[model samples]
Target: MSRFLLSASRLLALLLCAVLLSACVQDLTGPDDPDDPPPPPVRMRTVYDLKVSPRYIDVVGSCDKVFGSPTAGEFQYRVEVNGEGRTNGFESQNYNSRLGVVTGRVAGQQITFAPRTYTWSSMSSPGRIEAVVFGTEWDGAIRDGDMSNRRGARTVPFALGRRPGTVTIGATSECRLVLAYEAEWVQREVPA
Candidate 1:
């Protein structure tokens, strides 16, 4: 009689174990478990379109008309834009150094230059603007208050472009005046 009772108790335990196993299998096929977390949201990246225009001006000396190559001559320049830890440059040909124009003006129609385009990763800060103008340096001797050998190789600097547009700096020479062709970055909307 005791053996029969032990056998019945073992059968009951086996049945309980099977029930728990079956419940677990069903739970996996159903909705997600309470302890599981949902996936994170996806983030999209944004890009911007930027237009870089490096404007330049002809540094015309007062004596250009008297002893220079051309009171109005076509001069070439290599304009470099440096600021905000970024550097970009462009070279222009047949840039008309207009004669008798002592004032700095927009060179869009007057001179032939290449437009620089850039893609801005972000608009955090548009760095400080400085341009290093490289062209024929003027090496002239003053005789009778007039300059000779007006055309030469020279490197000039425009301290900074605080704002967008034309900026001028003093040539720091008695005979020559400084003119700057300024360059800047223009922010534009992304194309559709």
Candidate 2:
């Protein structure tokens, strides 16, 4: 009977020690200190639809033979914009077919598409051929839920050539397409 009491007392003492130790521990994910600054509010995404019309199209270099002159035309596309604090970005599928997702930053009311580079390589019997495309500048603005007389340009410099033996042959050319556009607020989308 005495041994049983001693065992029970030992178990009780162990549990008390555990409880006291747990109380001394601090929660790592607790709320921030009262003196610390509050977190910034989350920014919502916005979408806009625009009708872009080509005002001018210019092709330079010997590669003009490959890409003929394009006539002025208008096309409709959508743009999705996401903003974080001071930095913001927008994505558009109609920007470039070769690029899956185009990202751009927002400054005031203007949005600019970031430059990008694309490369392609192919193996042939005699040698290998490589092609590189460089993305230029594109930007516009929105005011009062509408964009009017927004001007932007898309410049692509393409280089294609073949490396045969120790010599390389290729053609380099650039296409500059300038556009003016008007956009309307289609709708706002918040992530689920």
Candidate 3:
């Protein structure tokens, strides 16, 4: 009986030491310490269409005199959007007409514009796309580093908010430009 008890005690002690060793190994091989990952992608939608007709009531001369070009013989509308570091152009028109269409994602939430203190310009010309709200019943213009254009095609930079929520970005040029956008958020796990 004494010999049997001695063997049992030794076995229990061995098991306890094994359990402690296993825990120590796990702590050493755990997940790496790093910054938190980015949030998931969200669904966006255009709830209100920023369609507004230009009255051309506030500018000097005729609507053509203020907005249209004598050489082109038509109004030039240049549209540009800042895609962070990359600027994407929608389309340009050379006739006296309304602005282009801006659509959001499938679902809805307003777009957030994170204002950055820097100058953004077009690669093709010296003209730059200024960060100003358009679509109002007012005339937008160019000043210094600011950009403005009539109904002409152009490329400009735009900023998007870091999180999924209501974001409103003003028109890039000087004119009556209005844009409405909305978005829906979804959780996604980005791979490390």
Candidate 3, 92-146: lDDT as tens digits: 2321233533222111222223332233322222233322222112122211122
lDDT of 1 by residue, 37-154 (tens): 8786565443322334554454444323435333432234455655556777655433223221122222222334555543334443444445454443222322213322122222
Best by lDDT: 1
TM-score of each predicted structure versus truth = 0.38, 0.22, 0.22
TM-score of 3: 0.22
Model 2 alpha-carbon drift over 4 Å, by segment: 28-30, 42-48, 52-192
Better of 1 and 3 by TM-score: 1
lDDT of residue 181 for candidate 2? 23
Best by TM-score: 1
Q: Which lDDT values do the candidates have, in the order given?
A: 0.41, 0.30, 0.30
Clashes (backbone N, CA, C under 3 Å), per candidate, total 8, 0, 27
Measured with C-alpha atoms, the lDDT of residue 50 in candidate 3 is 14
lDDT of 2 by residue, 32-90 (tens): 78998878777655433221221112222111222455322121122221121121222
Name the lDDT value of residue 145 in candidate 3. 22
